[model samples]
Target: MKPLNITYIYDYANLQVEEVRGSNISLKNRLAKLEQALRNKDELAENLHVIDFEQLKIENQQLNEKIEERNEELHKLRKKTIVTVQIITHMREKVQFVQKEYQILKEELAQLDQDLGAQRDLVTKTKHERDEHRQEYASLKQQTGIMNSEHLTKDFKDRAERIKELKELITQLKKRHSQMSQFIKSHGGVI
Candidate 1:
């Protein structure tokens, strides 16, 4: 019986040792799988970091382009404003010049109107004087013609009276001559 007990105890001890060895092999396989999973997680984290960095760079470039476009638009607006101001100033100067010219022309026109009025007055006076002179000349001519007619009538009457006187003297001379001739014929009978 002691020998059989010793054999049974040795068989139980061997079985227990074999069970512990199987548990150790299973633990080693689980640890190897955990190490491989940790390595894969590290690789995935590195790829995500790179992707995030590229996305931030693209967003920064887009923001820069938008800022540049806004600056360009602002510059164009400033240039246009300057040009408009210059044009407005030029137009103002032209308007001022035109106004000055118009004022000068108006003054000149007023002076011309005054001159024309004076000239018209002078012409009217001269015409009145000319009409008076013409009337006077016509009156003088009529008066001269009347005086000449009166003088001619007086000369005709004087000539008619002188002719009558000469005829009477001739009649008296003939009578005297006839008497003298008869006396001489009677007294000279025998001389």
Candidate 2:
């Protein structure tokens, strides 16, 4: 080996110093990129927190509206219940009044039935008496034909005139009974 050259060694030492400076600059660029990335992440997290708070506020407002609607519905239902109860009470009173009226009408009908029965009995008794009077008049007429003397004939004529008057009275009684029957029929009696 020959002796080392001083100029060559000086050139090699300068080359090594330039390479160290380049490496230090590259490392500084990488550190700056990392710092920028960290700042961007912090900004994103802050924006997300603000969005979540806004969403929570909106949900709270919706819940409050639903509660108010339910309270209004409950108040309306309570008013309707009170009105319904009052109507039922009025209907019950009306029913009681109608029942009382019906009972009074039933009692009146029973009394009318009793009156009609008495009237029918009176009509039947009057008919029986008229039939007995007719039989007696027939017997007296037969006896009058058996008499021959003038005095007896005169007495028989007078008795015959009396019987005719009695027949007229019986006819009038029959007319009155017919009028009473018509009256009872027109007044809703079961004659």
Candidate 3:
């Protein structure tokens, strides 16, 4: 069927109304004209239905395009959310690693402090021992000095007594030799 044209139908209806206004028409001609108008009206009604159906199809297509656009946006959002979650998980892992390293360093620092304290204690004990040794050495030196002076005085006295005894023995030997020489001369024995 040919598509209905509104301008053509308006012109055709005006032409028919002008013809009907001439009231000298026969009954058969009027009946024929009414039947033709009725047929045009039914064709117009069918054409309006077709136009409405075409408009609904266009609107349906436009709605589908909007839904597609929204779906694409939703897909992009889901991808972005996944990437953000991955970044957050990586950051959490890094924070945990840093915390573990900090704990290890803290323990090492504590151990170092303990070692330093022990070294200080050892130094203090060594200083005390050194002081005690120095005092003992001083006391021993004073006692040794006194003992050496007494020994020297006793040796000098013993040497002076021995020299006196040797001088008396030499005088006795000289007196005996002079007496023997005089006796030989008095006896006339090769004096």
RMSD, candidate 3, Å: 18.9
Best by TM-score: 2
For each candidate, what TM-score against the reference?
0.37, 0.39, 0.36
In order, the Cα lDDT scores of the candidates are 0.86, 0.87, 0.87
Worst ten-residue run, lDDT, model 1? 1-10
Ranking by TM-score: 2, 1, 3
* Residue 134 shift from truth in candidate 2, angstroms: 7.7
**lDDT score, candidate 2:** 0.87
Q: Alpha carbon lDDT of residue 137, candidate 3? A: 81
- Regions of model 2 farther than 4 Å from truth: 1-52, 123-191
Candidate 2 worst ten-residue window by lDDT:
140-149
Ordered list by lDDT, greatest first: 3, 2, 1
Residue 144 Cα positional deviation in candidate 1, in Å, after optimal superposition: 6.6
lDDT of 3: 0.87
Q: 1-191, model 3: which lDDT tens digit per residue?
A: 99999889998997887777654466667888988898888899689879988998999999999999999999999999999999999999999999999999999999999999999999999999999999998888788886657677798788888888877877887788788888888899775
Q: How many backbone clashes does every candidate have?
A: 0, 0, 0
